[model samples]
Target: MSEQSVTYMDLRFHTPAEQKRKRRPKHTRDTEFSEQEVTYSHLKFHIPSEQQKQQTSTSAESTDYPTPTSSWLVTVILGLLCMALLVTAGVLGAKFLQLSHRVRRQNEELIEKQAILGNFTQLQETLKNCTNQRDDLQAQKANFSKVVSRKGEKCSLCSEGWIEHGGKCYHFSEERRTWKKSQEYCSSHNSRLLVIKNKEELDFINRLVCFHWIGLSRGGAATAMKWEDGTAHSTDLFQVKKETPGESCVALNAEGGAIRKCAEEFRYICEKKPS
Candidate 1:
């Protein structure tokens, strides 16, 4: 073989160690990475900010906790309102009860007053009826005067103690004691001693002359005869023809009905009550 060719063959069939050395993994060169790949790595590094910031962000767990529970607050407000309403209603009801009681009492009092007034009215009516009855009785008693048909002057009987028999009333007195006293009493009674002229008038006067004292004088010691009345001796009515001054005072007999002395204490016939 030629020498040059033998050397070439030996270089080509080098050892395994040399071949391994030749086949070693090459180091990554700076120029091996592309610009786009570096940029992607940078972006991945920045994306870590999201995780770190999320951890650092002051654990703001805004759990929306209501300051007061809505349900509990509603219950409290409702309870307070109910209590207020109940108190107000109770006060008003008490006032109404008091007013009703007062009204009832006043009504009862008014009814009592009305009843009393009605009783008073009834009493007044009864009193008026009684007065009317009294007037009726008085009128009946006066009926007697109307029945007697004697025509005379209508003087009040209580004041005028006598009636006009001959246009005058002659009042002789039983209350007068003596004869002179009887004369004075007759004068004060607006009458003279009773003088009767005619027989008829004399008999009428004598019928009423229960007892009287007169001025007739007695006969001489036997006490005879004179004018029986204290008047000027008149021949017209009382003087007897044969009579003379015998007695100075006279009184009437209870039985024989004649004139006697004024010293006698016999009952005298009065013409008037007083005057």
Candidate 2:
């Protein structure tokens, strides 16, 4: 009891200076400890931990790389650009083809026009030549008319190779021709086919040539036979001996006058007035 009493008395009866000293030490310790804790918390807040550093670095990597959505979007954009380019190319190609076709067609048209122009030029040249020939023939016809107008002026009645009989000139042809062609030949020479006016003329022509075309034909079965000069044939003169069927022209020979087809080929006699 005495010792506990004495320690308790010492504790309770400590000096005010000593107590102040002790309390000051405790306050200083608390202040220092609190400041250190605040500094540690500040460092923890300012500086990153290992796990936080790893998470931050991973976030940065994710931000730097492209996502699948972004990659797909980029591919789709590229595809769209390619499609647009293709469409543009197709349009331009179509336009180019159309332009080429038009140019080719125009070229063909130009060639056709040139060919037609060439044909037209040739036709014009042919027309000019025909006109010149017609003018020359007209000039020759005028000169012939002047010569034939002077009749009974002591000129020769007939040219060479022509026979004069009964104030008419007669020509015998060696070449064979159809009845129509023979008449055309005689007309071209300013004459007509042989026309027998009487029995004497018929006999004369029969002695000259055989199977020769004369200018005697019937217009129809109801019409009588007539000469090329439109003179009617007198039935009383002589009867025409029929040699074949379908006869339309008259021929004379040593055997007498005969009826023959106009299309048959035969020598001819031409009769004309003395010029």
Candidate 3:
């Protein structure tokens, strides 16, 4: 038992609110001075500066989105520009193709013209050669005529009654005889039935104006008409009448030649080269 002194005991008992307050962090100088940048849509925020954020945030966030009308107008302008480019490209391509086709056609035409010019040049050269040859032949003929005109030379190559032509002698008979007998008569006279060599010879015979037997005959064949000298007969010089089966011999007339019977009687012509 002793005397007990009265003592006050301070006991700490925490409530839920006091416990939560103890868990919160305290703000220090580091937290207050440190700066952080924050982006909120188009607005910028800073940790340290509230007044500056308030001044600039309204302007930054208020930037306008384009209105529908202006958006459509810009889209239409871009589309029109694209369409113009496409149309211009198409026109250029078409023009280029057309020009290419025209150039090709012109080149073909020029080639054809060149070919025609070449043919014309060849023809001109050929005609010049022919003219020169004809001139030379004419000169030779003139010289030969001069030689043939000499006094006794004209009749020197021909018989008494025969005529001279083209280095040969021709005789027109007055007596009518069958074609075979006439040929025999000519053979006995060391001559043969008349053979025409060219237009000049045929013309000479035509001047005689009498139907005379020549060497052209069918020779017992229907289609194979030939001369007695065993040379091919030329149909271009004379229009020969159609031969009957029995008419194998040919006679010369002023117009052309005619087929006659071998046994028919007519005056005859004879031809012989100069001895």
How do the candidates rank by lDDT, highest first? 3, 2, 1
By TM-score, the best candidate is: 3
Please write out the lDDT profile of model 2 over residues 111-174, one tens digit for every residue: 9999999999998975675456446535644553454444324465986556666788888787
Location of the lowest summed lDDT over 10 successive residues in candidate 3:
32-41
- In terms of lDDT, which candidate is strongest? 3
Off by over 4 Å in 1: 1-159, 172-176, 218-246, 253-259, 269-275
Model 2 off-target regions past 4 Å? 1-155, 243-247
How do the residues 8-40 of candidate 1 rate in per-residue lDDT, one tens digit apiece? 112122233456444644563453332122211
How does each model score on TM-score? Answer: 0.32, 0.41, 0.44
Winner by lDDT between candidate 3 and candidate 1: 3
lDDT against the true structure, per candidate, is 0.50, 0.73, 0.75
Candidate 2 vs candidate 3: the TM-score winner is 3
Ten contiguous residues minimizing lDDT sum, candidate 1: 1-10
- What are the candidates' C-alpha RMSDs? 31.2, 20.5, 20.0
